[model samples]
Target chain A: MRRMLKLLPIRFLSAALIYLVAGITLGTLDALGYGSFKSVHSHLLAGAFFTLVIMGSMYQLLPTIIGAELKHRSLAEFQFILANLGFISLAYSFLSNYSFLKVAGLIAFISFILFAFEIFATALSVKDFYRRSLAIWFFLAAVVYLVVGSAYALAGVLGITSFSAARHAHILTLGFVAMTNFGGLYELFPMLSLKKLHSRRLGEVHFFIANIAAIGMFLGFPERGNLFILSSLLFLAGFYLFAYNLTRTYFSKSHGPEVEMDISARFMAYALAFGVAGVTAGFTSATLGFPGSFTHVHLILTGWVGLTIVGAMYHIVPMLTWLEKYSTKVGQEGVPLIQDLYNKPLAKALFITLNTTLALFAFSSLLPALSIFAVPLAIAFLVFAVEMLLVLGR
Target chain B: METLDVRGLPHSERPQLILKKLEELGELEILVEVKPVPVITMLESKGYTCEAEQSQGVWRVKIRKKQG
Candidate 1:
């Protein structure tokens, strides 16, 4: 059961598909005059998709760190129920503005709190200061951020908090979801990139800078534009350090590979570039004091976050589950690395088309409405779906 | 009796770091053994609580009592 619960994180992340669906649905609804903004889509993606990944990663991280047995299998089962119900209620309330949504949201929070307690038990009992501890810290921090954001959203929904939409949205999206994803990268990038961690010191620095920048933006409020600017810069620096370390490590290794391991690595590399572009555009938009700066923000979430997660999915599920090992070896001489589990050429082409076009759309101001951004995104998704089926099901 | 047992210890730290951490967790009395001794012999030398006995290869030690 403990081993089984490990699969839950990825299971929850599959909820992000629901987010993409919501985006398409709410987009159509907007066309139909049901709602104007994509709030429901944003929440479903950031909250449900992101939370599920965090939960799943913990199952692997906790046992590695503490060597303690899971105290309760039922807690995860309850978590699955509460999270889906709460998110569904929240989504409905986003469209209908219903009061029961808050009740459901609160139930979800209570469920996560239980999950937190269980993981925290292992954290306290850990006998060694392992690297996996970093994973747990980020996961817990993400959960805490989730609780704070959810509580705020609940209050706002119930008319207890007044007009805190922008602030709460940033908290839920940037603080909770992004931070959690960053944690997973710290664990995975080393393994999948076929390199040792470049700078352990940077990991600590990045975490501090992230939390500090995030909190600074929160407390300073969005009205103080300069703080957000500073925070974003700090965050961009954090991202650069991460990219630099990863790239340096990738290049430092002396190995020849004609065939790419996972096309997902390209997605990660491109996502970093997109993230940089988003930051640049955001800065440019701010200095220009122009409208539609929010588009750059969404690009950061979708082009960067969305692409990174999808790319990582291409790597993680096959490797971690050892599904790659189950393949036939009759004609194969050298055992393929885990990254070799997928069809890279097709994925690489799709990811390149997907990311390049989408990134260009983010920065495209004068280019008369590239509504075709949706085309590459859908195509990329289809390609990824095929790769996933081939890699995971076989 | 004097003994030394190394199991379930971190590879990076070796016996020295483990002993340091163990020292921080409890009181350790100084008793030197020239040759490799069973864990019981070492525990007896340092007065560690012995609740059971075990052997690895040729060395053996028994923990028969709790140390306060």
Candidate 2:
């Protein structure tokens, strides 16, 4: 049972890396005008990379937050296997335009349903739900979005709904990925900074605003009018609330000198700032109805979601590995902080390159000549993957 | 019995605050009002024996110095 549980986080992270490579390769190809693999790229980014990574983190986090064992361990193991297989099949089916790959969608859908049940079964078991942290609220809400988003994807796969790939991408990316990131930020910002979260009230406000914006934009994007602009404003507002609360918390008095304030913490702050820029870009794209509207989505995906995840893994991977490896050595030997697990200079370089790549990608839509950024972006991801592997090696 | 309620704390601070209180209390018998289930292992690792029960929608955990 314990073995099964351990497999989850590792497998999820591994799969996420694989998906990231695939997603970036596909994106590079599309940018270079080889083929418009837009749907495949979105699926790999939203489904394979983000969703899998978030789910993996939840497996590690939920039990710790609730102070209990996760319910349905066996179910989770099965879901893990099924989800990976389903994703591969689903991606292949979409990439090749094979109708047979629809079965993969069904399998993935079942996996998500099982995942929702796993989350609720574990989370709801807590006696007092109200005392649960703000992160739990966002995490549970993300689960709801996941179930809903997966259902939407299934419908699209089955041809039962007119839900376009673009709409599904927004729902899954914002509704699932961004929602999870928000919840994760609430917990991680404090943990990494070694300070309590600044304000629960503001966090609550951020949650509602972000969710409203996500749902509203998902529905309003097609119309591209007042609703879209309003939703974008709310989204921007939500990002602002998070930025304020997190920054305030980070600078608030900590117990002591914070554990060297790793590159992960810096990355998180950058991601928050990027989130603001992305939302602003989104608003501009919506209001102007620009010919290069795709830039906005690229900004959000790479700037907000991509950077945040890469940054988070720096802390998360080391923390988990330490628990597994050096936990007992603490108080007995000179145990290193989680920050020491990874190369800081590499992390900073990755952050810089990633942002530069996103900026170039964002402009590439406007000027196809800017597509030369693809090589640098690919190199950034390669550096990131190698750094992550090195961290795990330690 | 002294009681420290972690209900109002953020998730990140709850465990830290609880651990700090336990360290300060040292040999005293204290009732920690927390989610309880999550802190049991940590408490046990620190040489404290604890038993938790839920009452009125909150967990009440009784902790004392471990008997040799």
Candidate 3:
């Protein structure tokens, strides 16, 4: 059981890296005047890369945070298998055969349902009221989004309902991916900074606002009605509040000697900045009746979600590797510090290059000449993938 | 016996500090704002015994060296 628990996260992370590389390659090719691979690229990155990482992290961290053992371990393993098969098939559907989407969507939907059940059961099994932190709330809500989004996608694939692809994307991206990130930051910002959250009440408010706005946007998006516009504005407000709360939390004073920020922490900080920028771009595009445009989508996916995942992997991969490889040797023999598990110089280079290139990529939407940045952007993602693999190897 | 308060220490630093202190004292108690599950897991893997209780969002953990 212990061994399985230790390796589960690593397995998911390894798969996510593979999808990340494939997704970036397709994205870069499209940017460099290759055939349109938009559907395939989005599926591999968002459906596979982001979703897999979130699953891995939740499987690893949720039990620890809730002070309970993960419920239905075997189910989680099975879900992982189905999730990969589903996503891989879904990505292939975009490239070759549309009929494959029915099987793919069904598999993905079932996998997420199992995940939701496992996570919810684990949380409910724990009775500690205080253990139900802001992160848990966000995670639970994101699970709801994941299940709903998958169902919506499946319906589209089966032609059971005429659903807007844009709506499906929003549900999954904002509702599932962004919500998970919100929860993650709530937990990680405090842990990383050695400070208690700046304001739990404010976080609660942000949660409500965000969730309500998400529903409102879902209902309003297809029609582009007043509700959609209102919801978008509300979401932007909630995001600002979230950004403010976490920033204050990260910068809050600690009791001990001040510690310098590490590469992982730096990645998170920059990712938050990108998140703010992405949402702003989204808001402007939405109000201008051009929501989900090339610029808006890239800013949100590549700039915000992509960077955040990379930053988080920096912390999670090393910590898990340390536990799996070195924990037993502690006190009996010397082991490398967790931070030393990954190459620092390469991480720094990835950070600087990825952020700069992503910004250029976003601008490239408006200025086509800047599309040349896609090659460097792809290289940065490749480096990130390699770095994570190296960390696991160590 | 010594009680180390790790209420505001960085997460990364807490395990190292506790390990250093435990090596010196052989047994130690820790006061932390959050349950240090990873630290406790690591200690147990290192052949230490840990007992923990929580009150008012604070965790008090008692660690003892492995019996020879």
Candidate 4:
């Protein structure tokens, strides 16, 4: 059981990468006009790749941050198995144009319900609620959003509500993905920099505004003009605040020796940059009623979310592997630093290739000639896989 | 009174240095400047007794060998 527990995170992370590969392949195929695998592509990217990474990271971090043992440790394994099974079924349903999507959706929804229940149970049992960190609030909110998003999706599946596809996507993207990533950065940045956060108050403000903006933007829906501009402005404010806070903290005087340029930190910064660019493009697309806004989607999905996940993996995979392997010998033996566990040059190149490819991909929407960049993106993933394997091995 | 200033050390190095110092000191009381919970937890797991307090946003933890 202990061994399984130790191996669980890596397994989930590995699954995320596999889904990422599948998503990229599907995306490339679609771009090349082979076939429009839209459902499978979107689900793999959002449902499989993004969800797996967030779940894996939260599973590893939640107990520590919340200061409580996981309420149902065994359920995590079940959730993982169900998630993969559900993804397979969902993909098959999409590809075959079959009626199995409902079953797949139900299975996936149940897995998250179990996951959310575990978090809620664990969090509620926390003995010192006052001592809870900022990250907990963000994560808890994300869980709530996940539950809500899942319910909304399930409703769509059951033909209950007139839930538009855009609204569903928004809820999942903003509520689940954006909230989780934003909240995670609050915890991750301070730890990586070995510095205190700039201001908890600002973090709270950012959280509040982000949620409000998310709700406003999604609820505005197909009614695009006034509501879209207002919601986007609010969203932009929230984004600016978070970016400012992070920059302040990063540039602040560290209490400890300055941690070197962590590859993950670079990834996070890039994600933030991409996020800003994406939002701006979205705003322009919305305001001008641009017919072709594939660039906006491309930037958000690849440059923002995808890059963020890739960056986080550089830190998370090595950290987990090191703890599992070398923690006991840390002080006793001359163990390598977490950064030393992976090939940095490869990681750096991977980061560059990923962002560059995403940029090229965004342009590919206008100029189909740019489609060739997908080849390098695939090669970059190969580099990523090799680096990750080396991290696990070394 | 033994003092170890971990203020200048990175997160990865703090605990390692703390444990190393504990080993070197061999039962003498030591004061470590660090984030209290994780350090105290780690020390307790290794059979050490600890007390911690925060002042001016800095946490100082005192560690000692658990007396039989």
lDDT of each: 0.58, 0.75, 0.84, 0.76
* Share of native C-alpha contacts between chains A and B (below 8 angstroms) recovered by candidate 2: 0.12
lDDT of 2 by residue, A33-100 (tens): 89988778877887788888898889877776666678998898899999988889978887787656
Give per-residue lDDT, candidate 2, residue A211. Answer: 89
lDDT of 2 by residue, B1-68 (tens): 67875443433334445555666675333333334443565567667888766666356777877998
lDDT of 4 by residue, A245-333 (tens): 98888788877556685677778878878888887777778887552568777777778777778877887787666556665675577
- Give the DockQ-based CAPRI class for model 3: acceptable
Please state the CAPRI-style docking class of candidate 2. incorrect
Candidate number achieving the greatest lDDT relative to the actual structure: 3
TM-score of 2: 0.82
Model 3 chain A: weakest 10-residue lDDT segment is A1-10
Flag regions of model 3 displaced more than 4 Å: A1-6, A129-131, A289-292, B65-68
Q: Which DockQ values do the candidates obtain, in the order shown?
A: 0.02, 0.15, 0.49, 0.31
Supply candidate 1's per-residue lDDT for B52. 36
> In model 2, which regions exceed 4 Å deviation?
A1-5, A329-337, B1-68
* Cα RMSD, each candidate: 11.4, 5.0, 2.3, 3.4
TM-score of chain B of 1: 0.32
lDDT of 1 by residue, A67-111 (tens): 344556567767777777877877787778655676877877787
Evaluation by TM-score, superior candidate among 2 and 3: 3
Ranked candidates (DockQ, high to low) = 3, 4, 2, 1
